[model samples]
Target chain A: MRATTLHGLKDIRFTEVADPVIEQPTDAIVKVIASCICGSDLWNYRGDNDITPGMTMGHESLGVVEEVGSSVSSFRKGDTVIVPFCHCDNTCPNCTFGAQSACVHLGFTVSGQGEYARVTQADGTLYRIDADPAPELLPSLLSLSDVMATGWHAAVAAGVRPGGTAVVVGDGAVGLCGVIAASMMGAEKVVAMSRYADRQKLATAFGATHVVETRGEEGEAEVLELTDGVGADAVLECVGTDQAMRTAFAVARPGSTVGIVGVPHGVQLPVHRMFRKNVGLAGGMAPVRRYLDDLLPLVLDGRINPGLVFDKTLPLAAVAEGYQAMDERTAIKVFLQP
Target chain B: MRATTLHGLKDIRFTEVADPVIEQPTDAIVKVIASCICGSDLWNYRGDNDITPGMTMGHESLGVVEEVGSSVSSFRKGDTVIVPFCHCDNTCPNCTFGAQSACVHLGFTVSGQGEYARVTQADGTLYRIDADPAPELLPSLLSLSDVMATGWHAAVAAGVRPGGTAVVVGDGAVGLCGVIAASMMGAEKVVAMSRYADRQKLATAFGATHVVETRGEEGEAEVLELTDGVGADAVLECVGTDQAMRTAFAVARPGSTVGIVGVPHGVQLPVHRMFRKNVGLAGGMAPVRRYLDDLLPLVLDGRINPGLVFDKTLPLAAVAEGYQAMDERTAIKVFLQP
Candidate 1:
């Protein structure tokens, strides 16, 4: 099978690799129908994160179960399902607490950008779809594997209350999705911070009631002004940079929380300021599996169109182009057809 | 009037000062009957925090209202009241949100160790008891002004739940009170991290179901072992040092929050580790004014005895000795009477 593999910096390639097989009794072979690039992937593609010579990439996907190990009971061959970015044993202590991202037997769903991928902990990691949906719903369904659920996690962690205000710190795919989550969760006002014209349009479409085309202190001031100078009741920090984190705290109201979904790079939290304002920090890696049940019905009913984040789609063989498009800011997200 | 004042590092003295009066239209002068040395005060006493020479000391006190300014409405002269350490005009946005500590018109109740203390925001800061209580209840009532409320804030912020496990790091007056808070909030297992035998006994008396005498890795291991290797559902970080913060996070279960009330000094939060585990950090300076209503009844009914934290009592003239006793850990806390 040809899969997306990273050799080094700025070098993503569609190369031949051995086909995925059942490696454990809890593993199942998935024939991936669709997958996409995550903002987190850019870290390794830009040399920010060290890369191995031939590590398989992609942790988001929706597919048909090609085969299942004998021990797998909840899913079988021909079943369509969404694979969470992280696999977990649902019965683990962390998973029982709905923090599946920190599951004791956690494993990443790598190799998803391929013809076939082996998913471990199949019963606990895969969310089965009752019927194979139309092609148009594929992208939205694919988002449940990671991005959309991650955005929802941010809103939930931030405690976005109905009739309150929410501020989203980043304008990336996850940030746009966060706008949707906050609005869907009933935040009366949703503020999106963005400088790009294209991303701003998407943010507005995804339920951003206000858009601040500024950064740093100026952006914080704009958000404060929007909230009658009281600051946002909830804040979603989708960018992992220090400046982004700083802005999130600066604009958070007293007793409010800043839910951070971004993977931190050079961020140092303003602990003193957070202490003074009673602003809390929550959220980390999203427990995608835990949110699947709530989000799937919304997606199936067309209540949310998270798939709109995928502004570009390409064949799996053009994986290199996909990475470059995202790296160059030409694409919000690139959906890959396997 | 004679009051406790800080002259320099470790130099506390009872000296003559101007008598406190209603300085603002909203001010109320309270004749302090009972006051106490707080663990936080020792920071200035030990030189960890910069000391302003001749600064009037003390923020915890309960007394009779001696005078009320023209605009003071809720409190009247001769009324017995609990003056929160921080005075807030509870009408501010922050105060309305239940974070009176960050109130727009926030002011610290300094001079609380004096014969009379001028408390600003009288209408919002003073909680009055129906009648003058017996002398025996004075110490417990004084705790409602700070320590007890601060401990309750930690538990509330940590989201202590019924049938859950809670871990409290630090065994100072506030941490000892946190044991009572966790137990009162219905945590089935309340663990107190302490090394001193006296503090351990007090913690047990305050409802600590378990105590870990070790520090660092050994302590974390013991807590993990006690919770069946899962970790506590809620954790109260009562010590502001980095190590205490680290242990609070280390023993917190996934999706649990660590409530921090200690004023941070030389502490750097582990943001990366927090992100990976989904452990949240919340709480700050306790909003004593906000919690007064709920805690006053509990104290009035004799449901809790947080006053036990004050192991030694001294006349206000012996203010110097109170500081030394607390500095040397010779007393858990010292209650001062004028």
Candidate 2:
């Protein structure tokens, strides 16, 4: 199978790799139907996070199960399923509390950015789709495997509710999807803080009532202005940067919460400021598993189109171009067909 | 008027100062009935926080309303009241949401250890006790002015639900009172983390199911072990230290909250750990004004005895000794009758 591999910083290649097989009794092999590069993928691609030669290129994916392990009761061959980026037992303390991202038995399953992948704990990690849909729906369904669930996780972790005001910091695909998630969660207002025109449009399309083309205090003031100086009721920190996290804190109203879903790079929270405002900060790696079942139906029902953030699509061989477009801010996220 | 003044490091003096009068249309002059030293006051007395000379030391007190400005509608001369340490308009956006401590028009209202003190937003800040409480009840009424309310705020902000497991971090008067508040709020198990014998006894009396003489990670481990490796449902942080904050995080169950009410000196949070655990951190300077209405009735009804934390008392002119006792750890708090 040909797969995208991260060999080094700014280094990626389409290389022939051996097909994946279930090594564990609870594992299942998936024929990757759709996969995409994640912003987190850029973390390793940019040399900030360590990556070995021939490492998996992506985590967001949906595909057809080609084989199931002997102990896998919930999945079988030819089943269409969504895979949470992280594997979990779904019965552990963390998983039961909906913090599957911190599941004690969590680890990365088979790399998604390949023609074939293997998933562990198939009964707990795999979510079968409602019904087999058309190929055109693949991108959107595949999104539920990661990006959409991630965005929903951000909104849920932030405690987004009806009549609540949500400020989404960062305008990448996950951030834009967060706007959709917040809107779906019944937020009265969704303010997407984005500087780029294209991403801003996507954010607006996802139901952002307000778009702030500013950053830092100015962005916070814009949210406050929209909220009549009280600040947003919920803040979703979708970009994992010190400044994005700071902006999330600045714009959240006192007694409200800030849910951060971005894969953190180096975030030393300004605890003094948080404590002073009585702000609740909660978020980490997206508990994608917790959100898949709930968000997938919304996508299938046409209540939301999270795939709008996928502004570009290409064949698997053109994956490098997709990465470049996202790197240069020309695309929110790209859908790749293998 | 006799007042406590910070003269230098480890030095406070009872000095003669001019009696205060109503300085604003919303102010009320009160003849000080009693004032006491707070744990935070020790920070200034110990020279940890900069305090200018003759700044009028006390922020908590019970007093007689000597005079009322034209705008003081609820307060009048001859009224006996407890002044909240924080003055609030009780009408700001933040205050409307029950965060009166962060009121937009918030102003400091400590009148020092003096004979006469003035309170701004008097109509809002002064919680009038029944006409004239008996001399025996004065001490308990004075406790409602700050520490008691501070503890209540910690418990309330931490979201101690009925049947929840609660841990009070810090053995100070506020922490002990937090045990009382959590129990009052229907917490099933209240664990008091204290090393001091007297404070632990007070915690036991206040409704702590378990009192552990533990600190830092050891304290967290004990709590986790006690709760079956899941941790407490709520934690009240009454000590503002990095270690205390860490303990709060470590002992909190997933989806639980940590209410921090301590006046932080140099507290840095472990952002990464907090995010992964899905812990909620909410706290601020206690909105004493908000809790006074709910707590005063409890104190007056003999449901709680918060003033038990005051181990010693002194005369008005002997406030310097009160500060010294608290500063030197000889007393948790010292009440000074003015």
Candidate 3:
């Protein structure tokens, strides 16, 4: 089976590997239908995160169950399902509390950009799609595996209220999806912070009522101006950089919360400012499994086209190209066909 | 008039000063009836926070309205009222959003230890006690001005739910009040982390179902053990130190929030752990005015006795002794009568 592996910096390879098999009684083999490169994947490619030779790459995908362990009861062979980036025993205390990402029996959906991938805790990790949808829905369905659900987590964590305003920081796929989530949650105004012309267009299409191309203080001022100088009712921080977090807190209205989905990197939380403004910080590695039930129907009904974030699509064999495209900012996200 | 003044570190003087008079069209002069020494005041006395020589002290007080400006409408002369530590217009965006501490026209209720204190934003800052209550209820009523309300804010921020478990980190006056708050909010189990026997007793009386005398990992383990290794559903961080904040997060269940009322001093937030566990940090300088409506009735009805946190009482002339008792940890809190 061909799978994406990282040897070192900027070295993503579509190399041959043994076909995935059930390693545990709770495991299942998934024949990948569609997968995509994530923003986090660029961290290792850019040497920001340490890489091990031949480490499996990718943690997002939707696929058909090729085989299941004898212990698996909820899913069987040939069943189509969405795999959340993180695997969890849904019955665990964390999972029951709607924080599946922190499940006591947590596992990662790595090696997903492959012909076949083994899924641990199969019954608790996979969400079965009831109907076989059109090919056009595949991208949206795949997004529900990670990015879309992550964006939805941000909105929920930020407590985006109906008729309120929301501000999304970052222009990545997750940020774009957050605009959709905020809009779908009934935010009267959705503000997207992006500098790129292409990303701005996609942001607007995804329900961004306002777009601020500026960054730093200027961007914060623009957002404040848009909200009658009071700041947004909710803020979605999609980029985990210090600057992005700063802007998130700065533009969050007093008594509002900032939903943070971005994996923090070299970020110093402005605890003092957050305290003074009565702004709260919530959201973490999103409990994607928890959101699947609510988000799947939205995608299936075409109420939200989160798949639009896939500005480019490529064959799984061109895995290196996919990583490079995302790294070079040439693609918002690169969808792959296995 | 004599007022409490901080001459320098450890130098508190009850000295003659100009009588407080209406300063702003929104201001009111209140004759101090009951005031208290707060834990934060010791920060200045202990040289932890910079002390401005000859600076007027005290922010917690309940008194009779002595005078009011032409624009003061809600409060009248001779009316007894609770003066929240912070003064807010209550009509500002932040105040309207229930974050009066961050009100756009925010002001502080300083010189509250004096015979008369000027309160800005009179219509918003003063919560008039509708009926003339007995002297016995004065202490409890005065607590609603700050500590009690601050504790309630922590519970509200932590989202204390009915039938849930709550862990309060810190056994100060505010933390004791938090126990009252958690129990009132219907938490099935209230855990108070304290090393002092006196504080533990007060905490138990205030509704703490459990007390852990250990600190750091040991304390965290005890709390985790109490909750079947799942941690508390809501955690109130009443101590501003890093250690207290760390314990607050450590004992918080995944997907729960840590309500922080302590004014953070050189505390480093564990953002990584918070993200991984889906634990959220909320609450800040409490919007005491926002909580007055709900808490006043509790105090009036004898449903709660937050004022019990004040273990010693002193005449206003002994202001220096009051600060000394709290600074040396000889008293949980000292109630001062002017």
Question: Which candidate has the top score in DockQ?
Answer: 3
What does candidate 3's lDDT look like per residue over A260-322, in tens digits?
Answer: 999999988999998898899999999989988888888888899999999899999998998
Arranged by DockQ with the best first, the candidates are: 3, 1, 2
Clashing residue pairs, backbone N/CA/C < 3 A, model 2: none
lDDT of 2 by residue, A31-63 (tens): 888889889888887889877877867777888
Candidates in order, TM-scores: namely 0.99, 0.95, 0.99
**DockQ of every candidate structure:** 0.85, 0.58, 0.87
Q: Pick the candidate with the highest lDDT.
A: 1
Candidate 3's TM-score reads 0.99
lDDT by residue for model 2 (B161-280), tens: 899899999998889889999999999999999998988888999999998897877877888888878888899999998788888888988767889999777787777777767777
lDDT string for model 1 (A37-129, tens) is 999999999999988889999999999999998899999899999999999888899999989999998888889888888898999999999
- Per-candidate chain B TM: 0.99, 0.97, 0.98
User: How much is A180 displaced in model 3, in angstroms?
Assistant: 0.3
lDDT of each: 0.93, 0.84, 0.93
Task: Sort by lDDT, best first.
Answer: 1, 3, 2
Candidate 1 TM-score over all chains jointly: 0.99
